[model samples]
Target: METCGSMSPYWVKLNASNCFIGIINNVDCPENTTGLESSTVNLQLTAFAFMITQIPFSVVFGLALQDTENTFLLLCGGCSILVFLLFPISGILAFAGCMLILRDYPDLERGWSFDLCLASSILILIEIIITLIVTTVMGIRSSKRKSNGKPEESVEGKGSSKDGDTQTQSNSYGHSIMKFAQVAITNGAEAAKNAIGMK
Candidate 1:
């Protein structure tokens, strides 16, 4: 009896197990006999790990969509890139493991297990492509929204500054008028005193 991680879908786990079993059953080489088990185990572990990592990413992406926060979006993008990097690594691991298992029997017929794995790999790649596109589009839209909002704020700021300038000018004019009135009163008192002295 073989055990699979609970995180992976049952069908995927079943198909992956079948593929490994198919490879191990057909090859008669001594090295394959010794190494095939470990390689297959590693392949399964890698697939499970990939699936496990996606769960949190899926949750984060969903939140990003609702909240539309750039921080969340950025995190999701980083995760997408990381996952994109992992695809090739996982592919290479799968290829190496399969090759190691089937090196002795090049002519062996790959049955349904191979077909399943191939189809799943292609679908996974397509999914990754779609995810990257969506994340980029979302990020672009978020930036556009921010840009659209900035001009309105700037306009309001300009209006407030103009009002402040008008108030400052009015205050300065009032002060000057008051000073001129005081000087005129002083001159009038002096002129009246001079006229009285002459009389």
Candidate 2:
């Protein structure tokens, strides 16, 4: 970045490899002795490191989802929590680091590297949101299936119980009718014999 201040062209440049910001002035430029703090640079570097590490981790996670065995998928699920936490945190840290860098060096312009990192952080955040939504939907669907299955089983059981009760009631009614008929027949025969003897 260059700025013309009525006398000389001031230039600001960043060296990413060495983590240095350099300023150049052709005529009558004030010297700034203060340099970027080590902690700020470390924070920025850590963010990039995490972004890099997530690449292989993400690939493995995708592969684990396709695996038929539950062990790998279960392990990935535990590790995924940590990965999810780190992504947003790292992105925020990177953004904070860039802001601090710009604050300390007002002449510096955010270059292509900053733009790229910003874009990457945004994309990663979006991916995280999508992943969460899908996981939640899948969980809700599975719960629905389980709930639906239980009611069907209960309904079948109720139908079977009703049928059994109807069968038992019919059998008892038939036995009671037969016992009544037998008692009436015996009383009639006795009354007839008594009448004949009296006559």
Candidate 3:
């Protein structure tokens, strides 16, 4: 065996090379020693995925309940409020759970964090899209009805036809207003024409 203090220059170089090769071999090993760590990371991602999936259902139900008529609206609103309120609370709980998992397993890939964040952002985007679509459809339907001359009636009998005397009085009033406006306009035009020396 070579003595440590008196080792040849060639032997020293070979020992250094061997130590470097061992590090490289360890890095290239097929069996990762961090299997438990990877599984923990995967579990966290799976949990986050479940939480994200619940968001859309909550948003849809909430909006649906909000758009419902009075009686149904109350029921739907209650359920929707429960869901909308609970989903975030649950999501925060899940995130806390994930953080605990991450604390236990610090070797997790950073990529999963970005992916979970992206999924949450996508859930918000989907809710906005759904809201826009429902509102747009309702607006179009309302405008179409209005353009079709469907006059919305009040609780009173305001839309009903009046008695003949009332009708005659209204017609006479409208005719008088129109005649007065026409006479005023004609007189104004005549005055302007006379001032301008026009026949």
Best prediction by lDDT: 2
lDDT (Cα atoms) of all candidates against the true structure? 0.56, 0.62, 0.47
lDDT of 3 at 178: 100
lDDT of 3: 0.47
Q: TM-score for all predictions?
A: 0.45, 0.45, 0.30
Error at 74, model 1, angstroms: 21
Give the clash total for candidate 1: 0
The sequence of per-residue lDDT tens digits that candidate 2 reaches over residues 3-34 is 11111222224333323332222223235533
Model 3: how far residue 70 lies from native, Å:
15
Sorted on lDDT, best first, the list reads 2, 1, 3
How many clashing residue pairs appear in each of the predictions shown?
A: 0, 0, 0
Least well predicted 10-residue stretch by lDDT in candidate 3: 4-13
Candidate 3 regions exceeding 4 Å error are 1-82, 85-110, 151-199
For residue 145, model 1's alpha carbon misses the true position, in angstroms, by 3.6
After superposition, candidate 2 runs with Cα above 4 Å error = 1-36, 122-199
Q: 63-119 in candidate 1: lDDT tens per residue?
A: 766665588677676676576466555544444444543554455444444444445
